[model samples]
Target chain A: MKRNILLLLVIFVGIGFLLHAWPSFSQEGEEEAGYPTYPIIFTKPLKAVLFDHKVHVEKAGLSCEDCHEDIFKMEAGSTQQNEDFNMDSLYKGKYCGVCHNGEMAFASNTRCASCHIGVMGYERLLKKQHSSESSSEH
Target chain B: MFKGFADWVKSLKNEGVEHIASEERRAFLKLGLVITGVYAGGKLLSVVSRVREVYADIPEYVDKYPYKPHYSMVLRTDRCIDCQLCMEACRKTNHVPPYGWRTRILEQHLPSGEGQWTRRFMPILCNHCNEPPCVRACPTRATYKDPETGIVKVNVKKCIGCKTCMAACPYDMRYFNEEKRAIDKCDFCWESRLSKGKFPTACAKACPAGVRIFGDLADPNSRVYQLVHDPYRAIWVLRPSMGARPNVFYTIN
Candidate 1:
């Protein structure tokens, strides 16, 4: 009975360790896992803005730690919830402007069209997503 | 008879020559303009003088560019935010690979009174020099300057991927394209857009900020010409000591 209890305790300890390491693994936010795969869209300035995690993190060689829990929360679209998540804030070197102010990366004030896809592009992207989903279902 | 002919030639020269002092050229010009304005509605004279004022720095009144339309770019460095839309646009328009870039933005850390205003962005591309070192370095004559537009172009078919031109470039703008088996760099979006009768390059059009001013440097009416020729504006080129005579001009404004 003592041996069985010890085995049970070991199993519990193993599970607990796995749980502790879980957040760090997810923190990387690699697209291979397929969580947060789509572009995060912001629609405050009447024009839709797109933040592509894959492009910045993967293509541009940025780390998840570069933004997560510091500049932005790990929760997707958490930035849009903040009142200061606007162009004015960006110009002042807050949020995206932290690196994008022509220092670490491209400035937030410049390249407005690349990120600000406008309502038309947003709708087109929505249509595309819908079409792809419907096609996958078929 | 020879003396009479010589005197007649001298008199012919003197007829057109205004005896008015050279220092009073501006006054003469103003007076002539007023007379022409009164007689020929003055509109033509005013326009001509304005154009002359803009182009007074250029010595060649007839033609500054040997090429018909000399393609050039002027970058307003202060306005760049480093958003890299120009880089993305170039990649998309030129079908550039992920590893390569025809144009890139550089970040400059300027010491400021306040630390908040310390960063600046500079956009860089192929200079397309008057005396292009890449053109001289090309063994197979793959890279050559277009006489018509004065654009340095790569004849990809002839390029053996030697990377000699890449080394020759002072700005380090060229890259070896494994797919094309040639040295690839910014052709100012010539094949993708300019040949299709496009006015400005893809990068210039894509920039949200009015940073890249692309136009014919030879044309007095062009924005590039006006910006570069402006005595008031502090215009400069990268690595002037190289003596490439780069066509691309950079300024704060």
Candidate 2:
């Protein structure tokens, strides 16, 4: 009976230990599970050509730079974003900054939905994902 | 009585050590099986999701939506006229920064039969591979393949800028973005328009000739899918010998 009680205690102790770790694990989120980012968002309304990353990459001979315009150099998960409150000042003559101007993605247009649509949402999603992801790890 | 107690204590100590050693040995064996079990389990889950699925570690580090290729870049080699308008258009449309030529035109010099020298231009970009080498070589789990759309992409967040994927690639398509410090390759244009349920790449739209076609490979209704599957044609991917098994199928005449 004593041995059985000790085994029961061990099981309960293990369960308690894991249960204690549950909330923290849940808090880690899924997107933050070791993902990289380039946080530089376009302050200007980038209303140029809508490009599909998967098709051109697979069907056409174009690589990433073929269109993203060397906004930043190709590094492993490079994320060097400058804080430019406006669009023209942010990307002018700097990679896509030259072409996307009001005419392209480098426009001086200022609309929260236009400039921050995909970027802001995507960034938030990544963060939320990561939090849940870290939790699931344990 | 003291001697007897001492002997009893010594016996307990010996038994404890023996028990610990056996437990450790058993634990070592259990560890091997546990690791194997995890790997097998992960593989099975991924396979069930169609081998293209990612096997995430405990951290769920796998991207929720891995890259899905969405565009087909085609150059009218004959209509190119060597003008490089396409190049400028691509650069302007996409912001392909300086010194990093994303669309490199291959000028094939042809000695005109009439003694007039002619050049045929072939624009080359990242050949999004079916079995992408860049995706395979990333150590930090930065590069990934989107099973839904067949697009291989890099997670700028996780990439350490090691350039292993660049070196691993065969077509020399992968570019190292020095400023941001990550290996850059084509992921269609999902990064910019991912939230809109849209599928368009800058290069495909910039072409005035309407030569480029972008679509889903899995969907038989897609133009590219029908084109690639056409039995009465000869289409080719760059460097088939590289074993990278690229998805970019160029219909060469």
Highest TM-score against the true fold, candidate: 1
What lDDT tens digits, residue by residue, belong to model 2 across residues B1-253? 9999767544441112222345544564444321111122122211111212111111221122233434443333343322345456556655566666556656455676886654444556777766777887889988887766666777878889888887887867667777767766666666644435755566666554344566665555778766655555545556767767565555533
lDDT of 2 by residue, A12-43 (tens): 99988987787666445423532222233332
Q: Clashing residue pairs in candidate 1, if any?
A: A100-A107, A106-B82, A107-B81, A107-B82, A107-B83, B37-B42
- Lowest lDDT sum, 10 consecutive residues, model 2 chain B, at B45-54
Instruction: Supply candidate 1's per-residue lDDT for B151.
Output: 93
The per-model DockQ list reads: 0.02, 0.01
| Reference-based TM-score of each model | 0.54, 0.43
The candidate 2 chain A region of ten consecutive residues with least summed lDDT is A42-51
For candidate 2, the lDDT comes to 0.52
Where is model 1 more than 4 Å wrong at Cα?
A1-138, B1-64, B113-117
Q: Give the TM-score of candidate 2.
A: 0.43
Docking class of 2: incorrect
* lDDT digits (tens) for residues B123-197 of candidate 1: 899999888999999999999999898899999889999999999999999998878878899998899999999
Model 1 lDDT tens row, A57-94: 66778877878889988887767888878778888989
